[model samples]
Target: MTATTEINKIINEDNLVYKKTNLLLDNEMHYCPGCTHGVIHKVIAEVIDEMDIQNETIGVSPVGCSVLAYNYIDIDWQEAAHGRAPALATATSRLMPEKYVFTYQGDGDLASIGCAEIIHACNRGENIVVFFVNNAIYGMTGGQMAPTTLEGQVTATTPYGRNTALNGHTMKITEMIALLPGTRYVTRQSAETPAAVRKLKKAVRKAFENTTEKKGLSFIEIVGTCSSGWKLTPTQSNEWMKENMFPFYQLGTLKDE
Candidate 1:
């Protein structure tokens, strides 16, 4: 089958079933078809399952598409107000030092509104892990431009291409977080393929380990596809991300020790 044909298959209703990993439960996913949120959820689930942290981990899910993440990951979960996942997570992590704590947030939720919280949390060397999903556009709220939306990328607010002169370039969270004295580990990965998904799961597990080991703040950014927001088929979105975005954002662990 051609690329478009494969993309159609990826978007077909039959393709949306939960992985045997069951990262996502019965709660309806608010994400669009071909959205990578499910894939990221799978990575979190697999890591939790692999590390046996389901009973000991608590996730602080923030507003945005990931607001429903707590419904998916079968662990002690808490919901934070918009852009406050890090603050809530910091409290939880400090209150229960023995428990693994992490926050899952989207580009808009993290880079745009939650920026100060995340930076301060990392600065204080908070013992928490952060899983940031950077898809450039706001998946919720109908594909609005997010803080990480690249220049020349169109969105609900930037239909004529994101004007770098006005909007600025995409925010580089991995780099930003790595600079914080509190952060001991940072990595950026993708989830477009099975191999990539496996790596992403490892990165998540590593983040959890940092908190569990009481090392310090750990940050992970998953460069994912917002198929519906980007106005492309799943396959095309994946390819576009690889060719156009990876060179700029790149992927790999930025800090670890």
Candidate 2:
């Protein structure tokens, strides 16, 4: 056998401890180094593979950093206008009740512009999952302040640090959504470490599984990092998120039924 063939044979004979999930495509991730979007994507892909629901899953992509999520995730996807992912997901779940439909949106898309659509969808108890990635800035369209921007946080719009008096309080959208009667499951997680990523994967799995039971809306808010937007290295961004974001967001299940 040729050298390459021999190497492949030997590797195949060895035990595989870990490997990328097939649900994630081979396309290079467009997220900046240290950004948590890649990790979240991997966690979701793994969940989909583990549940054996790849063939029955449909994802709604929002018009933010994850606008091209379809490129990286190997599954059927639909693109929604800015912040309207939950609305599209609502329709997708209603029209194809058998399929697992989820919306992947960033803070800019969800909390800022798509606020009304998301609230109404959850209030109506649409049987779908909504994955909200809160990085506190508009990552795709320049690092502008977002509705979830932490108090005292600095961004392109709030260059001198967020002044609550001027910019208003940081929105606790997850907490607000949990109060809706239509919401069946609501959780906040992060992807800063292995333990955190594992927890996030479990949360994603739970949200996906809830759809099968015809549970009302399931919302998962992932408090993530944006290295480029934060003007910090990936490592620093994670540290900063832990120090600043976690305290306000508070990771845990807000509600589950």
Models 1 onward score TM values of 0.88, 0.91
Tens digits of lDDT, candidate 2, 133-182: 99999998889999999888889999999999999999999999999999
Candidate 2 has a TM-score of 0.91
lDDT of 1 by residue, 97-140 (tens): 88888899999999989889999998999988888988888988
Q: List the residue pairs that clash in candidate 2.
A: none
| lDDT scores in order | 0.83, 0.88
Candidate 2 has its poorest 10 consecutive residues by lDDT at 1-10
Q: Give the C-alpha miss distance for residue 112 in model 1, angstroms.
A: 0.8
